[model samples]
Target: MQEIIVSWSRRRADSPKTFTRRWKWTREDRARIEFYRTELAGCISSATFDAMLEGVNSESLLPFIFCYTVRLKDLDLGFVEAGLVARSWFCLGEGFENLRRVLGPGPRDEGFKYIEDEVEGEDTGYNDPDTEPDDIYVQEQFLTKQMPAGAEEEGALWFNVNIGAPGNYLPGLRGVIRLQSRSTIYQFPLTALSGWSAKYIAPLLFLPNLQELEVEGHATIGGLKDQFYYPLSIPLQLYKGLKSKVKRLSLVDGRMRVDDYDALAELTGNLEYLQIYHTYRYEELSPQEYASIASFFRKNNRSTLSLEEICINDIPGTDMVDVN
Candidate 1:
C-alpha cells in the first residue's frame, strides 16, 4: 500500500490519512476472509458439495465462488464465479476478434442500449430527421461526463458516430476500447484484480498478438458490465477462438473452483508448463484455506493433467497481506 499511495501521488504518498483508510479497509478484508475461512471449513466433503449447489434458492445464478468460499451454479452454463482482481498487460496489434459473437461495440461503434427504442408510433427526440442514416450523431456535450444517465449495459460506450447536438441525444461513453488499449488496467493492484476488468479484457482478447495472461491476487469482481466475463466468460471463448495462440496462464494465489477449471479446461489442455512461487508466507492461511486451493485443482481433470509443476501454498495468488 505504500507503493499504491506513492503511485497515487509521489509527494502525497506519505500522507497518514490515506494509509489509515487503506489500513482500515485492509482490516475489514482480513476479517471478511477469516469469516469465509470458517464457513469453508464447515462445508461437507467435496462429494456432497455439488448437492449443496442445487439447494441455493436465489434466481441469479452467480453464488460467487470466493477464494475462500466453495460454490458455483454450473460450469456448462458458463457461470464459474469471478475469482479475483486481475492485472494483465496486452501486446499489440492488440485485438483478436475471430469468434462468431464479437465484443458488442466501443466508443467509436454503434451498439446496444439498456432501454429499447420507442415503439413505432411513439416519438423519442433522439432521432433527428436531418442527420444522414449512415452518419450517427448524439448530444456530445452530455456524454463528456462519467456516464450519461440511461446508458447502462455491455455496449454502453459503443456508437458509430460522435456528432450530435447537446440535449438532442446522448453520443459517447466514458471508458472505451480504443482508450483502454493504450492506457491499460492492472497498473494498480486494487483495480487490476478487481473492478471492471472485463471492459479491458474484451479488447485484449481481440488482439491478434495476445498470448499469456497472469492473474494476481484472489480477485473478487469479474465482469464490469455483467460480472462473469473474466476467468470464465471471455476465457471460455479464448479456448475456441485463439486456439494454440493463447496458452500460458498462471494463478499466483488462485482459490479457483471446479467450475472455474471446467471453464478453463479447454485452454489448459494446451498448457505446457507450470511455475509456482510463494509471494507471501503460507502459514497465514488455515488448513481449510489450503484445502480450498487443493479442491479447486482436484475438480477438473483436464486442468490437472495439463500442469507441469504445482505446490500447496507456495505461490502468492492471494496478496491480501501486501495490500493491507
Candidate 2:
C-alpha cells in the first residue's frame, strides 16, 4: 500500500484533550499513532494549510488527506468542503457526501449518533444546483486581495481556478495548485457562452504548467459551464491550451457518465493518474458503457487515460477484462 501523509486540524490547541475525552480507546490503540491538529500562529486557517503545501519540494509528495468536522446540512459545511479542494487537499468525508447536508441542520456540538443520522438522511443538499458557488468568483477574489499587478508572473499569488468565488487567479499563480469541492448538483449550460468578453475570460485562462487537479462536488457531464465559460458549454474550453499538461486527475462526489468519459478521453491525452469516487452511484455500470470506454483508451494508445492502477469498489466493468 502507498504510505499516505495525514494532516489534521482542530478548532483549538486543546482539541487533543477534547478528542481524548470523547473517545475511550484501548491503550494499545492510543500508543500506535500521533494525531494532532496543526498549530499555525495560534490558529490553523485554510491559508495555513496552503502554506504547508506550497513549501513542499517533492515531485511526488504523498497526497495530503484531511480529517475534520463541520455543521451538517449547513451551508458552511459545503463551503468548507469546497474550500479544502481549492487549497489542494484530499478529503473523504467519513459519511461520504451525505454527511455535509445532514450536519447542516443539526448543531455542531451534537452527539456522534446524531451526526451519523445526518449522514444517513437521503437528502444532504449536495446535488442541488442552486446551492453551488462559482469557482472563478472565489479565485478572482483571492488574487485581487493578495497579489500585486507585476507579481502575477513572479508567482507571488496563488489561487485554484476550480474554487468557489470570483476571478481566475491564474495570472498570479505562484507554483501552487489548490483543490476545492463542487456542489453536488449543478448546471453548466455551454450553450450560454456566446456573449462573454476576454476580460471576463482572461482570469479563468490558467497556466499550462499545473501539476494536479482535485475536483469535488457533482462532476456531472454538463454541469461545469455555469462556473467556467458560463452560457456556453464548450467541452475542453476550460482546459483549452492546458489539456495535455495535467498529470493527475482526482474526481470526488462525482459520476463518470458516458458522455463525460468521451469528453475526458478527448482532452486528457497525457493524463497519468485518474481517480474517481462513488462511481456509478454504487450500481453496476452497463457492459456496453464499460466496453466503449475501454475501447476508447485502446484506440488512443498514447493517451494518458491508460490508468496505472484502477481502484473501484462496487462499479461494474466489461465482460472482457484485459488491463494490458
Candidate 3:
C-alpha cells in the first residue's frame, strides 16, 4: 500500500486561468491513499485540516474524497473510490452524477442500492415536479411525510446547497429542513435569491448544531436590477434560534441593515469569528456606518461572547479587524 498526497489549486501560480492535470508519481503499489490538499494554504490551512480530520463528520469527508478521485483518475484506485462512495451513500444521494461516471458502472452500481432504496421508500414528491406550486401548506405536508424516519440522526452535517432561478426546488429544501434538525448539522451554507427573506432563510436558522454558516446572495428585492433598494422583508427574529451554537458566520454580497448587524450580535453571542464582505446597499459601508457597527460590537460584548476575529472587506472606510 502506498499513500499519495496531491496539492492542487484552481488558481495557477502564473496563469489566471484554472486548469487540471495529472501529477506524476512513481509509486507502483496498487493500493493508494490520496489526499487533496488545497494549494491556497490560507483557505484550508494545516490547522483547519487537523480540526476537520479530528471532528468533522463522515458526510463532510465525501467532498475531499471526491476531489482526490477527480485529480487522480489516471491511477488505479478503484477500491478506495468504491469504499468512499459506499460510505457516503446518504450524502452523495443528491449530487454525485459526475462522480458516479468517474467511478464507472461496477462500483457505482453496487453503491446505487442505498440511494435507490431512499428514492423508492421516501415520498414521491422528491421526484415528481408536477406538485402544486402556490400551495405551500400542502407542500409542507408532503415534505413532512416524504422525509425518512430518523433521518435527523444520519443526514448530512454540512448542508450546502445552491438554488438557481426558474426551477428553485422548494420541496428539496423542505425535505432537508424536516429531516435534519439544528442538532444534526455542523455547517450550513446556502446561496439563493438576492434578499434574505423570511420564507427562504428561516428554515436554515433552525440548525442549532451548526457551528459555521455562509449566506451569499444579493439583498436587493428584485435582484441585481434593484441593487439599491432594500429587501421587502428582513426578519431579525430568525436569528434567535441561531444564537446558541453558531461560532462562525459570514455574510457575502448582500444588502444588510443596521438592524441586521444588531440581530447578528444577538444571534451569536459566543461567535469566535465573523466576516462581512461587500454587504451594503451600494456594496460598501460608509464611514459613519462602520463606526456605528464597531461601536455596536463593543457595546454588545459579553464575557461569554469572546469574538476572536472580524474580517471586513470592500467596505468603503474600514480595514480588516483581527483580534488574537
Candidate 1, number of clashes: 23
Clashes of each: 23, 35, 5
Summarize candidate 3's per-residue lDDT along 227-261 as a digit string, tens digits: 33333235444344444355565666545566556
**Candidate 2 structure quality by residue, lDDT tens digits, 27-100:** 33323221222432122234423322222111111112111211111111122222222111111222112223
Alpha-carbon shift of residue 4 in model 3 (angstroms): 23
lDDT head-to-head 1 vs 3, winner: 3
lDDT of 3: 0.33
Residues 1-324, candidate 1: write the lDDT tens digits: 000000122111113222211011133443454554356443222212221222211111111231211221111111111111111111111111110012122222232222333232121233222332322223232122212122111111111111111122211211111111111122222222332223223332222333444433332233343233245544346335333323444445432333443444333333333332234421234545444443343333234323223334553324312211
Q: Give the runs in model 3 whose Cα sits over 4 Å from its true position.
A: 1-205, 218-220, 223-234, 238-242, 279-282, 297-301, 304-308, 314-324
| Residue 135 C-alpha lDDT in model 2 | 38
All candidates' lDDT scores? 0.27, 0.31, 0.33
